[model samples]
Target: MSKQDGSNRLVSGPEVDDSTATILHVDLDAFFASASLLARPDLIGRPVVIGHDSSRSVVTAATYEARKYGVHSAMPMSRALRLCPNAVILEPDFSLYSRLSKQVMAILDDTSPEVERLGIDEAFVGIGGLRRLSGGANRIGAELRARIRRETGLVASVGAASTKYVAKLASSRAKPDGLLVVPADAVIDFLHPQPVSALWGVGPKQQERLARYGLHTIADVAHTSQERLSAWFGEATGRHLAALAWGRDPRTVEEREHEKSFGHSHTFSRDITDRSEQEGELLRLATGVGRRLRDAGVQARTVTLTVRFHDFRTITRSRTLPEATDVTRVIVEAAWSMLEQLGEMPPVRLLGVRASAVQDASDHGLLWDDTETWGSAERAMDAVHDRFGAATVVPASMLRRERKRDDTGPSGGD
Candidate 1:
């Protein structure tokens, strides 16, 4: 490909042609809720909510039927139940969901080499080369949806467009399992009538602010003067929003590296105040993060601890490790140390552990080095955990910590 100019503008030359780029955005329909229904077929056609089983717990995913009752992911589970009294509440099954996500990702990989995963349920696949294999973008989208359904027993919505932003918006319009294509000439037609919220990063506050200025739709934003918009929303956001309104995204689909951060968090059934109990929860979170890192062939150089109090106040503390490692004991110890340093303990509504600043296994030193030795031990332990089950091996410290925490009482403070 020829390089663009200094302004990042496409350079015109004898070799340059006005060819269209094909991008396909794939979104799994009601991912967590759908996966839950797949595991238990009886839940099909019913309103389902997947989240924690606590009054203060937030919903992670909800079926379309539940969404009709105003239940949505991130909403409090109690409010969701109040909205849809008959909705089936289910706990988030991260392990099962992660496994199913791997299967779906593998299927995408089978279709194209340039696949950019947005999350567990969404991805963008560059199909410039797929025309030879699957006929064209439209055909490839159809085949992809059909394949996902046939193999995984799930439905996916797809949108084909020249730009990623338009492709993503098209997918949203084609929800509950459908595919729509917005050709280069039809991008404006497909996007103009949509609400401002449809644009990426336009959150509740931005939408409300824009609405007051009579900018209710993408078309309105597109038609607004840049100078006026900048005065209202500031220069950077104004230009960014305007570009999105015009469907001018220049992003290309490319494979992303393994995640740089891996973490897991839990919302308690009740607010926890005990330090020992908090440590037990930290150990659990550490184990989850460690398993993920090992599975991805990565080691973390830093560990972070996050705490959210009952009032929704959140704080995070991180520490750099002397050497990169993925051992559960080491990660948990690091997290516990940060937690202890926080000083003022409050009733914690949520606890999380994260491993960040990840590096490849090869980055570890010689075989005799401490990091290399730890890496090997972790690999062996992971093998045992995979073959038998997660509970096959437990860190000795975690076991002792849990026992001590449990004896202190449910809140751990007494």
Candidate 2:
């Protein structure tokens, strides 16, 4: 874990060698929290948590000061308040965040054309061919941090390394506005001491699995033979881990035309047991997913449903459609079908709908379109939403009753 106070932050020295560390990972520090604080400069140095001021709301983002008390994104607001009672609470401004993100990405685009955006607040920039144009990797990283701060009033931490794996890890170690460059020669020295969880794909369950074998750190994993690791974890994951453990990443940064998937999730104020209510929530989520698909001018061939039980155990199921579609009803039916297949489920704490395998809507022409009417109606509704507001035309089922403890926030995955 990184120190929230920046006491343990690392950066490349003036005379450091960055010739081989051309891959840069740039990440904004506390993006939502920082953007929300732009108008309230008085809260600059104090602890602040960004989320709705509701007991059921979850923390969308937290400043470093709030993070020191163990507050983090996706955590329940009630728990966060208990952790930092005096912390200031602010609502998230997603539109403001989107504007700032565009400004930051524009700066990155100006710096290098080979930029791969990971999300609204992070990107991978390849600067191997721009040494003469932009100076050393260290200089490029430093300039990026400075430019982001000046333009967007947001702090960015940059990491430079020969591979994406090490570069991303370096950025986390230099959090809260700092930069660190790990040259090709010193990659192992910079990687081995970190905990196993630092490795990509190593989540809590995987970390526990590694702990059972006494593999507590990257060094332990690096020292283990490929065959042994493969025997413990299957073939593909084992080989992938072994390569990353030795600071070997064969992948290069490539610009993605669009995101892989679009999804919307909602955590209920209380565990929901009523079947009709659960289905209604799923319908709401599918409506959101379908709207996003149509907005992107794409259609999804697959729909996936995610369910989190009251005990926190989660599961997902997916089904492919006969025809690609961006219609709300089609998406809702597919998601509900998957949910029905789960049999008798436990009380659901959260539900999510995702649309994947997306492609240009115009390309997916059909001989006989079964959803022509539904699609037309949805597009008409979309027009109404654009003219008036999103709430102008919602499904009658959603208007049956107002949820007293309703708490909705933007999903980071979106």
lDDT of 1 by residue, 59-110 (tens): 7778877877878766777898999999998755565566667788889999
User: How far is 201's C-alpha from truth in model 1 (Å)?
Assistant: 1.5
Task: At residue 53, give the lDDT of candidate 1.
Answer: 58
Per-prediction TM-score, please? 0.85, 0.77
How many backbone clashes can be found in candidate 2? 0
Off by over 4 Å in 1: 1-21, 366-414
- Per-residue error at 220 for model 1, in Å? 0.8
CA lDDT, candidate 1, residue 218? 94
